[model samples]
Target: MKVLISGASVAGPVLAHWLHRYGFEPTIVERTPELRHGLGGHAVDLFSSAAEVTRWMGCWDAIDAARTRIDSMTMERFGRRPVEVDLSRMYAGISSSHVEILRGELTRILYDASRDTAEYIFGDSIASLSDDGSGVDVTFDSGTQRRFDLVIGADGLHSNVRRLAFGPEEPLRRWLGGYLAVFSMPDIFDVGNHTLAHLSVDKLVGIYGVHQTGQTRSGFLFRTPHELRYDYRDKDEQKALLVKEFSNYGWRVPQLLEHLESAEDFYFDSIAQITLDTWSKGRIGLVGDAGYCPGPAVGGGTSLAVMTAYVLARELAAARSDLASGLKSYERIIRPLVDQSRRIGPKLMGTIIPGSPLALRLMPFAAATLAKLPTAMQRFIWSQNAVGKTLSSVNLVQPQVSQSVA
Candidate 1:
């Protein structure tokens, strides 16, 4: 069978890899002109199940070696002493196998693994998708037309495939009452393999080192009473908005803002989740953040994306010629995980970005205390939370390919 996948970042490449392995031809269409493979981009985590998928792909060792070796974090409040938390220890408590790596690096690794097996088309996108029950006829923005047995959207939030296959994103999107901005800058504080964060009520400013580039990334996450209106594509407008919001805010923010205008890779977006009743319509289906994004930053989106793509591929292969049944089975299998994942973002937002002064004080204290706990006790405590429960519940075993495929 021939399949076409959208967005080459995380899920697309992963789905491509597995589809090819399962006796299917996969073609990837990425909007970007070239592969984004470098030290740039925000840090993302891969928990046990996601790690296991990579291990099965034979990419685990490479990903582990490329991990961001940030082991500790220092939380600061205005006029208060810094509270230190062992991030490595905390991560260990959360999942037995976990790695934090730059999103670009992970994409590069996944892309490299799948590039040899799949056909990749960069600098183009699906302009329209016509699923005729038998196949999906896709028209690209570059004016190329092709037909595939199935089409999948592995794109991230604000996916082009989702917009084309489903409807507009506004009705399906649930704003989580927060926003996030990230940009790269010189390592002025000389922070090496550590994260420094300044927390205030309803707001957080963080700077973490990128050992591979010898630079640092500044991230600002803040809560708003109502959604802000702005063009998602305008970087200048977003930068100005960020400055206005944090104008009166103190604590090294001024220094950070100085480099904002010149930062070419600045990213700004709302922390929102996609609520779709189903991920498929006939031969067209959606995977990863395209279909169901719990929320960005706060939610374990990376792991969710990785695991769902893997499941989608497995289900499709199992269904063989009946691809429609495969899509339905994929949705049914992942619905529980997706539902459980949606609950994580809001609870984490309340905890990470405090709503009150009391919470601001208590958040750091709680993190420090958790980090100080013994590994066993920490695991016990974490196992009771939403994240732990979600991670532990994911069970994926490789099923033998039926002789029918060959």
Candidate 2:
């Protein structure tokens, strides 16, 4: 069977890797001109199950070696003294096997693992997908056309496959009442391997060092009463909006904004969830954030993406000749996990970006107190929460199908 996967970030590469291993011919079409390798992107967490998936792919060591060694954080509020939080201990509490690595690094590792096995086409994207009952005929923006037994959209929140297969993103998206912006800047603060954050009601500004590039990433997350109007693809408009939102806000924000104009990889998006009831329609299927994103930043999207892509591959392999059955089985297996994951983003948004003044004060205090707790005690506390339960809930079954080329 020939499987066509869209996007090459986390899920696309992971799915391609497993599909190839499971005896399917997988081809990945990535919009980026080249693979997004190195330590350029934002830091993302991989919990126990996601780590296990990486281990299964023999990429765990590489991922661990590339982890962001940010072990501690300093959180400052206007009136209160700065609070110190042991981030390493906090991550330990979240899962027994957890690593925080840059998104780009993780993608590079996954891509490397699958590149030799699966066919890769960069600087191109799916222009249209024609899914008949038996197969999918795909047309690329580069004017290339191909036919595949199956089509999977492993693209992120704004997925081209999802839009082409289902509908426009606006109706299917649920805004989590906030916006997130991130940009790379010089290491002006000179804080190495330590995160610095300024918190206030309805907003947060953070700067963390990227050791590989000798640069820092500044992130701004702020809540809006309603969705803001701007082109999703317009960086200048997005930067201007970010500046307008934080203009009066004092701290290191002014300095952060100074680098915004020149920042090449500036990213801006609403912290929203994709609320699609069904991930599949005919021969085309959706995986990861393409179908159901809990929310960016606050949600454990990286882990969710990794685990789901792996499950999709396993289920598809198991289905063998009955590919539709495989897609349904994949959906059924992940539905419970997906439903639970949806609850995390809203709760985390409330905690991370305080909605009120009291929350602003209490949030940092709670984090500091939690960091001070014993590792075991912290683990117990996290295990009782929605996030921990969700992270540990991924239970993958071994593929029943034989490993033979299709």
Candidate 3:
């Protein structure tokens, strides 16, 4: 069987790895000119089953070596004393089985692991896909054409494949009334190794030193009742918009803006989730953020991407010669976790972005108090947070495989 996968970031490469393992010939078409690397992305976490899947792929050790290793995080208000929270203690309430790494680093590791196993075509994308009851005829942006038995849309939030296969994305997109921008900057704030964050009503700015990378990761997330005007591909316009939104704010805003002007890897997007009634129609299917993205920065979307790829591959292996059944079973096994992730994002808004002056004043105190509490009490307190519980509940069953991919 021949499979064509789109967007070679996290999910696309992972799906390629498993498709090859299941005796299927897989080819990946990535829009980016090359494998994306360096400080292009922010810190992301893999929880429970996601981490286990990496171990099963034999890349956990490489992933762990590239972790952010952030030991503490300090919160500061405009006129108040900064309160430091121990990050290690905070993560304990969550499962011990977690891997926190830079998104780019993880992507590079996955690419290296699977580069030789699959045929990868960079600087291209699927321009059109036609399914005629037997296979998908794919047309590439570079003007090449091919036919495959199946096509998977592992592309991200604004997936081109989703637009072509499903329809327009406006109705399926649910905006969460916020925007997030991340970029790489020098440690101009002089933060040695700890993460420093400043919060105001309806806005938050943070900077954290990435351990061995010699660079810092900074982000700006703010609430906006309505979507702003800008093109997703225009970097200068996006930077100008960010400056316009955060120029009057206090505490390192000026310096952060100064770096933003020249940062090569600036990423800006609305905080939105994608919900669909079904992930597949005919020979086309969607995975990860393409099908059910649970907002960015708030939910564990990375973990969902990793685990869903594994689950989808397993179901396909189980339902050999029955692609529709495999897609249905894949959706069945993954929906509960996707639903829980979406629900948890809204619940965290109050904690993530303070709504009032009083909320900002109390935020550091609450975090400090919780960080200093007894282990058992901390666990009980975190039990109230829906994100942690939902992350722990993801359990993917491994299928029995007698033969390995040659």
Candidate 4:
């Protein structure tokens, strides 16, 4: 069987890897010119099962070597003193096996692991897709046309393939009443090995510098009840909107905005979640953010991406000639976890960036209290949380190939 996948970031590569291992041919088309490396993005966490999946794919050692090494997090409220929270101890409460790595590093690792086995077509995108019972006929932006047994969209939130396969995103999207912007800049503040965050009612500005990389990543997030009107593809307009929203903010926001002018990899997006009725339609399917994204840059999105791809490939291998059965099984096994993970962002929104002064004042107090809890008690508390249940629930049995489809 031949499978064509869109977006080569996290889920696409993992799907390609497992499909190849299970005796299927997979090709990936990525819109970006090449794999992103060293270009800064926020850090992502992989729970126990997701981290195990990386080791299963043979990328854990490389990922571990490239992991971000922040020792602590400092939270500051403009008029108040800063409160320091120990990250190492806090993470222990969630899971003893949680792994933290930058988004770019994880993408690079996944790409490297799959490049040898999968054919990657960069610098182009799927222009159109038509599934006529037997297979999906794909047309690329470069005017190339091809047919594959199945098509998967592992693209991020604004998935081109999803738009083509499932119609518009607005209906499937649930905006979390917030927007997030992230960009890299020089470590001017010299916040060496420490993560710094300034919070206010409805606003948060965070900066963290990696000593090994000699670069800092700054992120801004603020809440808005209604959607802002703008072209998603317009970089200049996006930056301008960010400037307009954050121009008068305190902390190092002024400098952060100044650096945004020249930042090569500036990214801005609404903190939204994608919930679909079904992840597959006929021979076409959606994976990762394209299908069931809880919330971008928060919760277990990266972990969910890895887990979903693994489940999808395993189900496909098990149900060899039956695409419908395979897709149904894949969705059935993964949907519960997706539902639980989707709750993390909305539940923590007020805690992360309060909507009122009282909540803002209590944010640090909450963190300090959490940090002070005994490791075992913290672990128990976290295990009871939605994110914890979602993380602990993923247990993928390695798929055994019934026959060679290669």
Candidate 5:
């Protein structure tokens, strides 16, 4: 069977890998000109199950070697003293014990491993999808057309394929009442050797050491109750909005915005979650953030993508190419994980960022009480991080196909 995937990032490449292993041809289409560039050394943790998937895929070593090594972190409120949280205590309730690696490194390694197996068409997206229930006829923005047995939307929050296959994202999107913008800056502070300094009041800014490179990456998170005025496609306008919101703020933010001027990889978007009633319809299915992104705050996106692709391909192969039954089975088991990941966003945001003055006043007390909190209370607070909750592959019960199509 021939499969066409909409995204080339986390989930799409993963689906391609599994599809290949299952003996089905998968073709991936990406909107980006190439595998993305200029990302911060953000770490990704996979619950043991997701880890096993990567181990089987054989990119785990490269990811581990390229990980960002941060010695420690300090959280401070402006005009107040900084407090250090215990590392083990800080990571206490988290899911993956395998440690965190940058998102870019994970994607790069996955892309390389799958390149020989899957055909990737870069710098374009599907112009239209003409599905006749028998198969999908896809037209590319570059004016090419093709047909495939299945089409999967692994695109992120703002998924074009989701709209084409399912419906508009409006009914499915839930805004978490915040905006996050991240961009690269030259190592102006000469931050050396470790990822350090986390500051949060109602917002957060951090400088992290990127692997062995002398440069550091800065994260700027801005909180807003109302939507801001800016075009997502207009980089200039987006930069202006970022500048306006953060110009008066301190702690090396001004310098970070300086790099925002010329940085081609600057990303500005609302901290939003995508929740859909159904992940699959007909021969088309939604995976990863397109189907269920609990937002970046949950820190389980990469893991979810890996698991999603694995389950999807497994269901497909097990169903003997009966797309409908397989998609339903895939959605039934995956939704519970998606629901858990979804609930994580607002809970983490409520604690992580004190959105109101009253909440802000309560944070330090909460922090101080954190050490004193009973094991039960501590567990409750840490539960929001979405750790140790990833659904693994072998756990999925594959349905047998009475009728073989593949």
Candidate 6:
């Protein structure tokens, strides 16, 4: 089968990997000019099943070696006598299995592993997709056109494929009333080879020294009741907001924002969730953040992508000639897990970044509950967050070989 997968991030390449394994020829299209090796923002982690997929993809050992040099995190109040909470007890609320790495780094790894076998179209995307019962004709932004047996929108929350195929993104988007910004800076803090400090003033400002990379990762997240008047795509306005919001704030914030102007890359976005009533329309389907991202707060974004991709590919190969049934069944099998994960995402974000003073007063209590070092720790540690959260999933099932032809 010939397939077209959009976005080079976690989901698209992952889908390509599994599709290749399943004997389907997959073509991956990405908007960026290259495999996005750098990060848009902060570090991310994979837990449980997602980590398993990393191992299957043959990149786990390297990921482990270059994992975020963060030994632990310190959450501070930033007053003259800062109140500090050790994060050793607080890292759980997400998942037990953890593979902390930059999102871009992970993407590049997946891309490299699959690029030789998979057809990759960089610096482009689909302008439109027209399906006529059999296959879809895809028109690219670069004026190139092609046809494919199937197409998947692994794009993201603002997936153009989703918009073009499923009839716009309005019905599927949920604004979670917050925004996050992540940027890089020089190693000026002498963080000493670990994720050093986390400062919270009703919000979160944190930094980590990415060991061996010779760079530091810094980010801040906060709540916004209504959308602010800022260019959602303009880097200057995004950086300016970070500076405006944190300009007068305390505890290394000024220093953190200082790198904004000179930073080569910056990641900024509204904290939102993508909830599709159904992830498929005819021969088209959706995966990862394009289908059911639990928002960045859930920290399962990457895992969801890999697992969704693996499951989708497996379902396809298993059904043989039954493409529509295969797609629907894949959705049914994955929905329960996806819904459960989504239910947990916002609650997790809220727990990390409280909305009001009443909520802020309860942080210590919540922190105590999260520090239990078991399931309690796992659930509570990942509670309320500011911006995007980094989480991923993996497919645990083996695909059945299809005997019939498409």
Q: Work out the TM-score per prediction.
A: 0.98, 0.98, 0.96, 0.97, 0.89, 0.89
Per-model C-alpha RMSD: 1.2, 1.3, 1.8, 1.5, 3.5, 3.7
Candidate 1 lDDT (Cα, whole model)? 0.92
Question: What digit string (tens of lDDT, one per residue) describes model 6 on residues 264-283?
Answer: 87888877788888999999
Q: Put down candidate 4 lDDT per residue, 1-406, tens digits, no spaces.
A: 9999999888999999999988889999998897776645677888788788888888889988887888699999988999989888888888877778888888888989999999999999999999998898999999999999999999989999899989999999998888888888899999888899999999999999866668888988888767898888899999999998999996789888889989988889888899898999999999999998888766578999999998999888878878777989999999888889889989877677789999999889788789889999998888898977987887776555443752
Q: Per-residue lDDT for 68-169 in model 5, tens only?
A: 666455566667776654434434333334546667777788888899999999999998998889999999999999999999999888888899877877
Looking at model 5, the pairs that clash are: 44-101, 95-387, 95-388
lDDT of 3: 0.85
Which regions of candidate 2 are displaced past 4 Å?
Answer: 397-401
- Count: clashes, candidate 6: 24
Compose the digit string of candidate 1's lDDT tens values, residues 1-406.
9999999999999999989888999999999899987877889999989999999999999999999999999999998899999998899888889999998899999999999999999999889988888998889999999999999998889988889878899999999999999999999999989999999999999999999889999999999999999999899999999999998898999999999999988999999999999999999999999999989998899999999999999999889999999999999999989988998999999998999999998999899999888889999998888888778666988556442353
Model 2 lDDT vs. the true structure? 0.91
lDDT of 2 by residue, 1-406 (tens): 9999998999999999899888999999999899877766788899989898898889999999998889999999998899999998888877889999988899999999999999999999999999888899999999988999999999899999999989999999999999999989999999789899999999999999888888998989999998998998999999999999999999888888889999888889999999999999888999999999999898899999999999999989878878899999999999988988999999999999999999998998799889888889998898888898898776875455456644
Candidate achieving higher TM-score, 3 or 6 = 3
Candidate 6 to truth, TM:
0.89
lDDT by residue for model 3 over 1-406, one digit each (tens)? Answer: 7888898888888888888777878898999899897546988888778888888787899998888888799898888888899877777656567767889999998888778888999999889999997889999999999999889999999999999999999999988888899999888877767899999899999999877767888989899877887888898998889999998997888988888878888999888899898998888999999998888898788888999998887787777777777889998988888888888777666678897888898888888777778777877766676776677666666656533332
Q: After superposition, how far is residue 130 of candidate 3 from its true place, in Å?
A: 0.8
